[model samples]
Every structure is written in structure tokens, then in C-alpha cells.
Target: MDKYAIIKIGSTQYKIHEGDTLTVDNQNGKVDAEVLLFSDGKTTILGDPTVKDAHVKIKITGAVRGEKIVVGRFKSKSRYRKGRGYRDTLSELLIEKIELGGKKATEEKSIDEAPKKAVEAKPIKAEKKVSKKEPAKKVVKIKKPVKKGTK
Candidate 1:
């Protein structure tokens, strides 16, 4: 059972655990932030503003730039228009560990687990077979025929 924590980095808060990777607004290099809350399914600890000596350890794995967002402005009857694009810089962080009062919550797990293989279904046998000779056409019979008589 691993403990999880909600921590604040800059202005944003994120729920994280050991070995969890997250993307946050641009940060240079590694960072350590205080935990706001901690829980391990059964037991929970809440911090007054922030927990004492509880922190999340993180390191910047990579820098990411978000897709460019286009903005446009238009005015009616004035022939006015404006266009702009914006891209935000983001930081990719790997949560190294979470500690509370000098005790580690979870151990780093290795990425050596085998991948699941998809089960192959057996092929179905074909029911109808093709033949060179033309088959006979099916004819539906009428139950009763009307007799032609002089009215």
C-alpha cells in the first residue's frame, strides 16, 4: 500500500505518488514542494496550510511546449480583425519519492513487467461453398389458384 499526497507547486496543486510523472507549468530543473494532504487509503493527514516536514521530491525530466493556440478578434461593420498564436512552456517532472516525517511511503518499482499479449481467436470455417454448375432456383407455390369463370 503506497501513500499518496496532494502538493502545491507554484499556484497549481497536484495529487501525486512515488514514481508518478506529471507535467506542470514551466519550471527550471528539480523542485521540492510541501504536501497539503496525505492519504494511504485508510489513514489520512491534513495540513494546516501545509504539512510539517512532508514534501514531494521531483526532478525535471524534460521540457515540453504546448501546441500553439490561435486567437482571433473580429468587429462587426468596422472591418477590423486580429489574429495571434500562443504556446506555453511546460516542464515534465518525475516524482522521485514522497516522504512524511522522514518515513518513505512507496518504493520505486522497476519497469520490467512483461506486457500482456493479445489472445488470438481461432478462424471460423466457411459454411457456403462455390460451385461451377448453376444451382436450381427456389420457387414458392401458391396455396390456392383462382378458377376463371364467366361472371
Candidate 2:
């Protein structure tokens, strides 16, 4: 089973696996990614916000600049115009490995030594009942026409 993990860098989240290369905002140097979730194909573990004892090793490969973005402002009735352009620096990263509970995800148990424990089926929870409310109807009042001379 292929192992994978979800990690957060800055405010962005990315799903990554070992040996994967990803490009993101500049990090200046190597960063230890915060793992939000991890799955070993056979088992899945979720965190309240972030998984405990889970970490993703990342290495910064190189730095590159993003595409140029042009900004322009114009006003009518006046010959006022301004233009500007800029490029964002991006960093290329390589995913080294994912560690779950201090154990490397790449490590696998051989079939001969695999446990034969029975997998228990989890019970499904009941869905919540939502009450539907009707939208309010707008009321319009009709005004009677008054004579031109009448106050």
C-alpha cells in the first residue's frame, strides 16, 4: 500500500508522498512540515487539528520565480494611468519521508510475519435531522391616487 500524508506549509495545505517534488512559496531553508493527516493504505489516522507525533521531512531543492503579474489602474474623464508588474519567488521542495508515531511509513511488514487479526467493522452514525424553514414573503402596499387639488 502506498503511504501518503497531508501537510501544511504556511497557510497552504498539500497532499504529498515520499519522493514527490513540490513548488511553493519561499521558505528560505529546509522546513519540517506539519502533518495534518496520514494514511498507510491499510490504516488511516486523523488528528483533531494536526496528528500527534507525525512529521514530514522536506528538503528545499532550488529557488525559482513565478510568472510575472501585471497591475494597471485607469480613470475616466482624466488621463490618469499607472502600471506595475512583479514576480513572486518560489521554492522547489522534495519530500523525503513521512514519519507516523515515530515509525517511518516506508517500512512494511512482510506477509509471512503479518498478523492475522480480524478487522472489526465500524457502525455508521445516524444523520442529523434539519428543520426546513420557509422564506418570508414580502408584502407590498398599494396607495390610492389622490386628486391633484386635494391635500
Candidate 3:
């Protein structure tokens, strides 16, 4: 059965399958995107705007920048010319899994993994330490007004 799905990432739509690596606009960290459509060779499902309980798990592999493009501006009969270069920031993502209708397409370790034991932590008691040195006294300053000379 075909395991392809149409998913939206940022402002772009991508047709991806399991283990597909896609480079898209820079995204912060790994994110889950909504699946717009999904097909399994014989059966196909579509979402109303977006599929309910369907999502694509993507892991951001790395960040990349496109090749620099040089832009130049000049006016006829004028010596004024300006040039600048820019690069588009891109992020590499790996399609980890796609779930349709609350069902995972890929088998995960959530169910098979052993349960973690909760460790009981003892409450710490803090004791105030008393120092043998005497506390320093604060000095108060008295301000005296200067007497004005009689005219």
C-alpha cells in the first residue's frame, strides 16, 4: 500500500512518505505539522481544511543557508551604483512518522518501553548557621548647614 501523504509546512505543501527528508523554510526545532491528505494505495482520506487527529512528526536535522545572490541597482547617466548579497535560510527536516485518525503509521517505542520507576526524594532540612563574629554597627552622618556671611 502506498504510504504517501500531503502535508503543509509553513506556507508550502509537500508530498512526503515515510523516511523522507525535506528541506523547507527555517523552522525552530522539531515540529508536528497537520496532514491535509493521506493515501494508502487503495484508500484515500482528506481533511476539511486539515485532517482531524492526523499529523506529521518532523525532526529538524539542521539549518542551512542557500547560495548568496548578488543584487545590483544602477541608474543611467548616473555613477551611483549599489550592490548587495543575500542568502535564504533553510531548515532540513526528516519526516519521522505520520498518524491518521489517531493511529500511528509507524510503530513507536511508547508501548513497548519499560515503565520508569519514580524515585522518592527525601525532603531537605535547612539549618541557619550562627557566626561567632560580632555584627558591624552602621554609622549615621549628621549634616550641618553652613552659616551665610552678613552683607
Best by lDDT: 2
- Rank all candidate structures by their lDDT, best first, as comma-separated numbers: 2, 1, 3
TM-score of 3: 0.65
Clashes of 2: 0
Deviation from native of the Cα of residue 118 in model 2, angstroms: 56
Candidate 1, residues 2-116, lDDT tens digits: the string is: 8899999888999998899998888876465768998877788999989886767687899999889999999999999999999999999998877767643333345897878
Clashing pairs in 3: none
Q: Model 2, residue 127: what's the lDDT?
A: 100
Per-residue lDDT value at 1 in model 2: 88
How big is the RMSD of model 3? 6.5
Instruction: State the C-alpha lDDT per candidate.
Output: 0.83, 0.86, 0.81
In angstroms, the error of model 3 at 124 is 20
How accurate locally is residue 65 in candidate 2, as Cα lDDT from 0 to 100? Answer: 99
Q: Per-residue lDDT for 37 in model 2?
A: 89
Q: Which residue pairs of candidate 2 clash?
A: none
Error of 3 at 102 (Å): 3.0
Off by over 4 Å in 3: 30-32, 103-151
